[model samples]
Target chain A: MVVDKMLYNLGRYVNLLRDAIARPEKFSMYYKETMRQMDAIGVGSVFIVLLISVFIGMVTAVQFVDQLGDSFVPSYYIGYIVRDITIIEMAPTITCLVLAGKVGSNLAAEIGGMRQKEHIDAMEIMGVNTAAYLIMPKIIAAVVVIPMLVAIAAFVSIVGGYVSTVLPGSLSHTEYVLGLRSFFVPRYVFMMFVKAAVFAYLITSVSCYMGYYAKGGSIELGEASTNAVVVSSVLILVFDFLIALLLT
Target chain B: MIRTENITKTFGDNDVLKGISTEFYAGKPNLIIGSSGAGKTVLLKLLIGLFKPTSGKVYYDDVDLFSVDDDALREVRMKLGMLFQGNALFDSMTVGENIRFPMDMFTNRTLGEKEKRVDECLEMVNMEGINDRFPSEVSGGMQKRVGIARAMVLEPKYLFCDEPNSGLDPKTAILIDELICDLTNRNNITTVINTHDMNSVMGIGDNIVLLKDGHLVWQGDKSQVLESEEAVLQDFIFASPFLRRLREDALKQRHAHD
Candidate 1:
């Protein structure tokens, strides 16, 4: 029964995406909305993304240094480990997970509030395609902006590794820099971007779907917001695994 | 003009609207009045094509509403306007922007032209200036007026209002009724209003449809309301003791005169 329900929702969610991506009634209106969403989703999220990335890099460096002590592995391997983990895993996955909580819940609450207030119905009666007008800009903005945020997270995490290891006299600056420059696979960057874009799409689309079909009053709106975050987070993890399998 | 034929709506095992047919005409306030759970809102939504009936045909003049393709439905909807029960003005937009939004979406008019139309709509609703204020900055009555302004910004051919007077004081409710009545007459547009307010019924109800438990119990105008002997109508309109006593006094006066 649960599988059946999930399949039904998946079909509905795909149909909604098709409707939402239809040509806009007015290009300028859509552009303006997209710009607003970009500012809200991208610019509003930088501080927290930066804060988390720094901590992740610091923790990974210190833990690896302790594990490699008195072992055959060189101390500089900490830089290489931090760089690859930050780029391929921590940056895309953790940033999107955080965004699923912040932006996903926010999008759900905003759209669900509009539904409960009858704003969507009013726009529909006015001949506006409510689905396209409300959801498309959000999806487009997130797809464009989240990858950039993940890139920034990768760079900041590398800097955090240098700060935690080199500055603390555990590894020389020159040795750490050599480790960072050593196994530079361009395909890993491609893999990182793929994960970022896929995770971005999953989070925004899932959140918007939950909100668009929201019914009832304040309690129902809260439930929709919660569902948006939970579903998007779970989908992010699932897609993360799939993208790693396919792209690698 | 809008007309429905044998409309029925069923949700699960609950039938919210039994086979009911009605007409809403142009240039008058056509009121749908009934008690709670009388299916007034469901019927209104069906009329607006928001909810499809289980079986029925709704015609806007000669166009069958439920029988059209998506593009045709959108074209038809462009001629329609609705004011929701909660006065669903966009909270993020200022008063001016809310009124200008439909124009922005549908019309190719220049900014100057759209701004001029926005001003005209605000003036029609007697809310001159204060265009930059967001919806949250306004009172409930002001928000209702803004909703009306937004609905009429396009000069729509058909206007539907759902419980327009629900949260207003009696005086403000009467004013809103008068405003809607005046707009319907001035535009010569088909206007349908769903309400349970007796004041609105008495003030602007050129035609009224009464429903009870999904059944169309009676249909009449304000003039006929006092004289009709329909038990459901009497029980609904004169539900309170004070209003029932007033009805008895009016009957006694009429009897003495006769």
Candidate 2:
């Protein structure tokens, strides 16, 4: 049933895409709206990313050094581990998860409230395509902003790893930077970029769908918002595993 | 300018509108009145093409609403305006922006031109300086005015208002009714209003269609309604306690004089 529903929605999206192409004005407005949405989702989330990333990097580094020690795995390997795991997988996945909580909820609430208040109906009556006016902009913004957020998360986690491993342990600071570059490969970095982009698409589309179908009143809207986050988080993980298997 | 012929709508087993037909004239306030659950709102939705009639046709001028393609239907809708029961103003936008939304969607007007038209519509609704306020920051009456301003922003030839005075106080309801009537006359737009409010029926009911149980029981001007001796009509008309008491007092006075 779920797969069928998803297929139906995909078909609907294709139709909307066609409609958007036909209406240049709606398309232009949708593009502008997407930029505005990116600011709200990506730029506004910086504070949390900074606070969480630094600590995550620091802690992951500590665990690596504490368990392996200077002789066994060498403390330098901590940087490599942080770079690979954090950038290629953890950062993108976790950032989107956080966004599912923040952005997903906000999207659901906003759309649901608008629906409850009949603002969407008003738009339809005015000949404004509500999908183009509302959903397309959010989709555009999410696609643009989610990747940047993943980059920020990657930066923070590396800094955290440094604080956790280098600052606390006997490992020299120079070794940490060297270890990060030692195992660095073009493919891994490419993988991280792909993962970030994929995660961004997953989170935004699911959230928008939740917000779009939210019915009843304001109370139901809140429920829909929470449901959006939960659903997006699960979908993100599922997509993450599938991508990982494919890449491997 | 708006006509529905044998329009019928049903939800599952429950029929909401049962073979209803009505014509709403341009340049006047056309009122649809009924008791709760009498399908007045459903009939209004059918007129506006929000819900496709199950077994009949709704004609906006001569175009059959249900027969059109989606693109054509959307184009037809562009010529329409609606004031929803709850005002339905975009809460994120200021009053001026809300009014300009239709113009933004349907026209290639410059931002300056849009702003000018928004200002003019707001001014016409007597909402002069409140352009910057959000819907949440406005009173019910103010929101209704803003709704009206937004509805007429595109100068649509057809307007549909579903219970414009639903949640307002009596005096506010009167004001909104008058405003709708005035706008209808000024623009020569075909306006259809659905209400259970007696005040609305009397105030701007240039042509009134009374619905009972998803069917059109009667339709006539306000004067014709007053003289209607139908028992169902009387039940609704003299149903008011105050009017009933006044009738009783007048009867007693006549008996004493006799």
Candidate 3:
């Protein structure tokens, strides 16, 4: 049943895509609206991202230093580990997970409300291209904003991890900076960016698909939002593994 | 004018509209009346090209709506207007913006011209000076008025209203019915309204279509409705006096709250 529904949803998305391209004027409206939505989701989510990044960095740094000891790997490796983990995996995956919790849920709620009130139907009746006007903007916003957020998460996490590891005498600040710069690979950064962008699409598109189809009233809207977050988050994890395996 | 031939809609095994055929003429309010679950809204959707019939055709003038490509259907839709059951005003936009929405999408009008058109539409619905206020800030009746204004903003050739008076007070509902009727006559637009309100039935139902168990049971004017001795129609009209009074009282309460 789930696979069937997912296929059905994929068909609907294809239809919506066709509708959007067929009407370029509607694409302009979607761009503006999606930017508006992206601001709501990405900008509004900054404080929580900062908090989570800080704690994650502190914990990861402390755990690495304690486990590695002094001889096998120097405490300076803490910064490299933080930078490498964040750039390659932690930052994009965690940021998307958080977005799935925050922005994804909100998208579902907003679109579900529109559906319940017949606002979407009203747009259709007015000869307005609803997919372009409503869904496209969100897709554009997600594609643009998620990478910026992941970058922020990586920078903040490294800084926080440095503070935690170097300040506690496990590693000196000089050694940490040296270890961090010793093996900097641009390929990993590029991969991380690609992951962020793909995850962003997954989060927004799935949330929108669920919300757009939501029927009934407030209760149904709530359920749809919850379902959007859950489904999108799982897809993010699965897609992350596939990307990691392919890149590796 | 709109015409339907052998229009049928089925969900799974349940037939919502069973081979129903009807024609709604231009320049007047053509209403569909039926008991709850009688598929009146389904019929309206089919007429307006929102939902394709399971096995039939809907013709607007000479064009078969279902036969056309999506672009052509959209072009047909551009000439259409609709007032939804919940008033379907965009919550994000204020009254003026909502009214100007259609113009923004399909017209090359300047901002000043759009504003002017918005003002004109608001004035038509007796809604002035609240252009910047969001839908949430307005009363339900006012929201419906804003919806009507938005619908008529395009000067559409075809106007479809589904339960325009559903949530309004008796007075507001009557006012809306009168406005729709007057607008149809003034614009000579083809106006189709789906309603269960007997008051609307008697007030602006220049042409009436009645449905029962997914079939077109009767179609005529108000006089024919009043004079007809159909048992089902009689039962439906008279069986709900208490509910109507309850609704009136609720409408009064809503007005008082607003």
Candidate 4:
């Protein structure tokens, strides 16, 4: 029974995306909406992503330094390990996991509120194609902007690694820089972007599906928002593992 | 006119609308009234093609709603407008922006033209100016009027208002009824209103359809309401003792004078 329900919902989610990905009824209207979403999703979320990324780098560097402190491992390996872990796993995965809470919850709440308020119904009556008008712009904006955020996260994490270690004299700046430049594969950067884009699409689309089908009253709407975050968080982790398996 | 041919809808084992057929004439206020859980909303949604009937047809003139393609259905919908019970105004937008949204989506009109149409719609509802205010900044009555303005701004051929006077003072409710009636008459639009407000029932209910237990129980103009012998109609319309007494007294006075 549970598996049947899950399959039914997955089918519905796929259908909703199919409808939402249609060519918009009007280009100008959709363009304006896309710009608005870009401002909301991109410009609005930078600070949180940066702040968290900095701390992620700091924690990884500090822990690795302590772990390797008693061993014969070189101190410069701390910078290399932090850089690799952040780029390969921490940056895209952790940042999007946080966004699944912040941006994901916000998307679900917004669309669900509109559903409860009858805004979606009103738009439907006007022949505005509510799914496309509401969901597509958001998806477009998130996919384009979230990768940029993940890139910023990766860069800042390296800087944070530097600040935490070199400032405290745990390692020299020259050694840390040298470690960062070591074993830098351009393919890893491509993998990071691929993960960021995939995660961005998952969070936005899943959250939107939750919101678009939300019915009943405020309690139901709140449940939709929570479900969006929870579902997106889980999907991000599952995809992260899959991407790792494929790329590595 | 819009016609329904034995429209029936069911949810699982529960029948909400049971093979009901009705006609809504144009250029007048056509009302659908019923007690709570009588399925007025379901019928209204069916009429608007929001819910497909299980085994029947709804025709906007000659076009069978269920038989048409997506583009054709969208064409039919483009000529439609609706005012929700809650107004459904976009909270983040100002009154003018909310009213102008449909035009922004569908028309190639310049900014000046859209603004002019917005002002004209507001004026039609007797709510001129205050376009800069958000929906939260307005009174409930003002919000209803704004909703009416937005619904009519596109000059749609069909207008559906779901409980247009749910939360308002009696006087304002009557005014809103008058405004909707006036708009209907002027535009020659098929205006269907689902409402429980008594003043709206008797004042502007030029064509009323009453449903009970998912069946069309009684239907007539306002003049026939008092004279209606259908117990279900009387029971539902005059459910309150005070209104029943007033109705009886008014009938008695009329008979005495005759």
The best candidate in terms of DockQ:
1
What is residue B124's positional error in candidate 1, in angstroms?
A: 0.5
Docking class of 1: high
- The window of 10 residues in a row where model 4 chain B has the poorest summed lDDT is B69-78
Docking class of 2: medium
Q: Return the lDDT, model 4, position A59.
A: 90
Interface RMSD of each: 0.6, 1.5, 1.3, 0.8
Expressed as tens digits, the lDDT of each residue in A1-248 for candidate 1 is 99999999999998998888777889999999999999999999999999999989888888888889679997777788889999999999999999999999999999999998889999999988889999999999999999999999999988898898889988899878988988889999999999999999988999999999999999999999999999999999999999889988
For candidate 1, the per-residue lDDT at A150 reads 97
TM-score of 3: 0.93
**Cα lDDT tens digits for candidate 3, B1-258:** 999999999989999999988889999999999999999988988887878889999999999999998778889998899998888898889888899888887888899999999998889989988999999999988988898899999899999999999978999999999989998999999999999999998789889998999998888898666556777776676567785576457557867998
lDDT of 2 by residue, B170-235 (tens): 999999999999999999999999888888886788999988889888888876655566666656
What lDDT score is found at residue B97 in candidate 1? 96
Per residue, candidate 3 scores C-alpha lDDT tens digits across A148-239 of: 88889888988888888788777798988987897899989998998999999999888987898898878899899999999999999999
TM-score of each: 0.98, 0.92, 0.93, 0.98
Instruction: Considering the two chains of model 3, state its CAPRI-style docking category.
Output: medium
Runs of candidate 4 exceeding 4 Å displacement: B256-258
Where model 1 places Cα greater than 4 Å from the true spot, the runs are: B255-258
DockQ score of each predicted structure, in the order shown: 0.88, 0.60, 0.55, 0.82
Comparing only chain B with the true structure, the TM-scores of all models are: 0.98, 0.93, 0.92, 0.97
By DockQ, rank the candidates, best first.
1, 4, 2, 3
Candidate 3 segments whose C-alpha is farther than 4 A from its true place: A18-21, A26-28, B240-258
